[model samples]
Target: MADLHRQNEHGSRNRTRFPTQPTPSAPAPELRGHGLRLRPWDAECDTDVETWLRGNSDPEFRRWNTPVKLVDGMEDARESLRLRAEWDAEGKCVSYCVTDAATGAPLGHIGVNDIDHFIRTARVGYWVLPEARGHGVATRALRLAARWAFTNLGTHRLELGHALGHDASCRIAERCGFLYEGTLRGAMFDAGRHDAFRDVHLHARLATDPEPGEGEGKGE
Candidate 1:
């Protein structure tokens, strides 16, 4: 959410590395829980591209988050997916193409991005199709991604942020166990402009933190 998500590709910082704690290089595994399935996006699949395009272009999504590279067309969406695949291959990020478990119908997108193995931290971002909203999709997707990070990657912390005033995102993050951390003034590109700026509400969830509902985590 906000600029934190789109800027993750260039967010890697120069830091000391240890052989025993080398960065991850594993395939993103598919996860299923809470009535949904989370799998990697298929850059080659036309349906995936279509969904990506529609989601990114949705007015509500654009109003909240900012992409470093905007996806305005099918080609742009495909390229974004391709790059996401490359990042997944490098273990820099793990993005999921969220879908309905029963029907396999695409619902939205979620990602555990900018993995820093030395610190065992990552950023989480997501968006649900307009038609899929109000059904707890984002919350479930987030909890699933968090569980994967904590269990699989041993991630110490997972961060989530959204432009200020995005009450819906804040609630979703909190419902998934991401506690409100603070705000970063001018932390994101303003609503529809890249030059202007805006504040972001930061939230975080630590591996040691208690899961929201323990099992299958039900919520709004």
Candidate 2:
């Protein structure tokens, strides 16, 4: 297990505070899987990241990403990087940029937000570049993050939420071994419509569950 308190030398950079959110910090355990690396969000990767997101932000990819307004330039990525740093510093959340191991290209982003350490739980979210979708990049990155969380952060369980109509995300949650907990009725608002939140299936895996191993049995 990697040390949660230890900061990587590469991640050391000044960060600005979000008005209501804590600053982000380095992720624990420095996870890697499926030809991808998940590391703490850093400012140095700004150019690579902006390019990735710019090319990946399509209507197909943004349908479920209602919470994050799409940015039009590199400054937005810079601000997000700063917020990630603050979140890490305050331990309020942890975020990572998914990158290709061979080419070092930023593929997407994922994170555990709204974390409550005392409860040993957190919500997981992710987005893969449009071209990178259907390649298991999101699943690989998510499982790696969960492994780090449980093994290093003392998390007993992990939770995920997807909009009711997003069947793809639901499938990913199931494949990852998260049990469907239940739905929150009328709990979601998207695109100016108040939609009935699909029974937000709450799938969870214990720390002791068998590791599925990278890319093994992953759905296409």
Q: What would the TM-scores of all predictions be? A: 0.87, 0.75
Error of 1 at 76 (Å): 0.6
Candidate 1's C-alpha runs over 4 A off are: 1-25, 214-220
What does candidate 1's lDDT look like per residue over 159-190, in tens digits?
Answer: 99899999988888878889999999999998
Off by more than 4 A, model 2: 1-29, 48-57, 68-70, 192-199, 208-210, 213-220
Please write out the lDDT profile of model 2 over residues 1-220, one tens digit for every residue: 2454354323446633223222233344457877888877666675755754564355665565544445556776676667667777788778787888888877778888777664466788888776677777877787888877777776777888777777777777777767677776655556423442323445566677777544434432
TM-score computed on alpha carbons, candidate 1 = 0.87
Prediction 1 global C-alpha lDDT: 0.86
User: Candidate 1: lDDT of 3?
Assistant: 75
lDDT of candidates 1 onward, in order = 0.86, 0.67
Model 1 Cα displacement at 60 (Å)? 0.5
